[model samples]
Target: MCSTKPIGILDSGFGGLTVVGEVIRQLPQENILYVGDNARCPYGSRPPEEVRKFLFEIIDFLVAQEVKMIIIACNTATAAGLEEARQRYSVPVIGVIVPGSRAAISATKSGRIGVIGTENTINSDAYRRELHRINPRLTVTNRACKPFVRLVEEDLTDTEEARRTVTAYLQPIQTERIDTLILGCTHYPLLAPVIAEVMGEGVALINSAEETAREASTVLSVSQQLHDQNPQPQYKFYTTGDTEYFRQIGGRWLHRDIEVASVALGG
Candidate 1:
């Protein structure tokens, strides 16, 4: 399928739009369909089996939309469901982990990398595996920051509570002598300043959303799926939970009006 068919991206919540926006910026002529499982978000907090089940339903929904490609924009979903989704679909299915992992490795200065993601992502050891797979001698340090998701969803990324919580949770990883830190979750990028402040000026923060978007562009190019259309491509957003909240937060993040259509997902 060509890019005219629309690329599908799924996130546990509003975070996936970070990746969607990047893709649109890079591939201006491409259409995109984004699905946010807001009804069952914080997949990071759920059991692995539950995450997998939710992802399957979402994947089926996207595939039925006749999307040409699928991006598992949620790190927890990628760790728990990417492989299964890839095998089950005929389209080119991609996940954020490998692309992000490779970018982290390439961006590191001392071969020491720190990763901060959701609990399930860290627990799955997905990033560590890919980082080490690329360079066996690389040092990887990971921490699971659970409350950050809530902080982001509640629009409290820069609040005092978030500040204290982030600082306390990340204090140990700061002194680990790591030069590169991967924001494994898209939601984490919203806290980049606080993270940079806590980790100091020297640590380079690699955003997986940006890297993952680049990967999608490369894949479409290689597969001859890149759309050659001239007209502006439209983006459709859907949420299984609160459409107004999703639109408000998503518009704030994307710096544009995001009209979210109601969806029934994860049943």
Candidate 2:
């Protein structure tokens, strides 16, 4: 893969823009190509095998676009297919779980960390496993917030419904008295305000997007794949669903105009 080729990112839907934003902030010279499988979104509820299939489809599409690296920006997809993806693809494949777990580990003061994600992710026990792998002493509390993804996707993150939903979904984790919480799903970061309100000021919320972007930077730098010359890097977006909706949600979330094209995956 060429160093100047765009770095590819994919998610179940628009949630991956959080990672895209962070990458842009930290690695301004690098180009980005984002794909949101909006058609098969909320991979959190899907069977592991189905999620894995969709992930490979997206990865194949990204690789054809000649991305130098790939970021599985969806927690469900990451949990489902990260290892297989790394083995299947030549470029470095990074997932949100490990980075999120590491960030939660570093941010927690009480060693009690709470994690929230989609059903598939929480059920996969990926975060719990990664956290224990790093520090076996940690007390991990996990909750699957299924409705949270819909709230963010619908751009209802700051609504009253969003606040009530956040409160209900996070209350279980709140009782655990965790000093740090991992927004295990990339979509969850958009709901950070309501989540922070419900969890109160004591818990530090770890957005895996930021950590994942940093990891991508390290991988590129160490491999001499960093694109050093282009200050005006281009960004391309594709969706396996509604292009118009993708453009709208993506533009709103990223605070920039997004031109999206539709793609067909799993052919």
Candidate 3:
């Protein structure tokens, strides 16, 4: 496999830009090809079968593009399709759940952890299962913050309504007295400030984006696929929704002006 091939990343929507940002910061030499299924933005509320189908559509597209590896940046999609993706694809397939679970486990001193993600992710119990598979004595509590994805998609993270929604949704988790919390959804990290405020100083906030990026770097290094020669790495963005909206939100999140091409995936 050519090490110069871009790393492929897919998300339900713009939330995956969070992971893209980390990849850019950590692996400056590698090019990136990102696809956001913004037309079907909130995969969180969708059925597992539907999410899995959508994920494969994007993955197939990425595979066709001949990416060096594929990163499933959406928690719902990861929970629904990561295993099958690994089985189906020849290139490396990485998911956000395990990295986030491992980070939460490492950060928690009290053996109590909280996870906040989309409805599908929470219901899948992916995080809890991964955490307990490693340490069965750990206490894992999770909540489905379905609305948070919308807050990020609409670029409303700093608004009063975002704060209220975050606070209300987190009230139960707050009561758990967890010393660490995993922002299980890639989108949740964009609202980290508000989450940190709600959870207070004692609780550590785990941003899976960082951990996932690190894992990608390690995988590529071990496979001897790191792109060391490219200084001016390229970034390509594609969306299945409004190109203008994706460019607007994605550029803002990534802090760089980006060009987005529109794509349609058949059912």
Q: How high is the CA lDDT of each candidate model? A: 0.88, 0.90, 0.91
> In candidate 2, what are the lDDT values of residues 1-267, reduced to their tens digit?
338999999998877899999999999999999999988877767788999999998898999999999999888788889999988988999999999999898898899999998877888899999999999999999999989878986779879999888888888887888999999888788888889989899999999999999999999999989998997999999998989988887898899997898899886
> Who is ahead in lDDT, 1 or 3?
3
Given candidate 1, what's the lDDT at residue 88? 87
TM-score sort, best first: 3, 2, 1
Candidate 3 on 73-187: residue-level lDDT in tens? Answer: 9888898889998999899999999998888888889999998887777888999999999999999898989799789878899999999999999999988989999998888
- Give lDDT for model 2: 0.90
Model 2 ranges off by over 4 Å? none
Model 1, 146-225: lDDT tens digits are: 89878987889888998899999998898899999999888888888888888888899998998999999899999999
For each candidate, what TM-score against the reference? 0.92, 0.93, 0.93
- Most lDDT-accurate candidate: 3
Question: Measured by TM-score, how close is model 2 to the native structure?
Answer: 0.93
lDDT of 1 at 252: 91
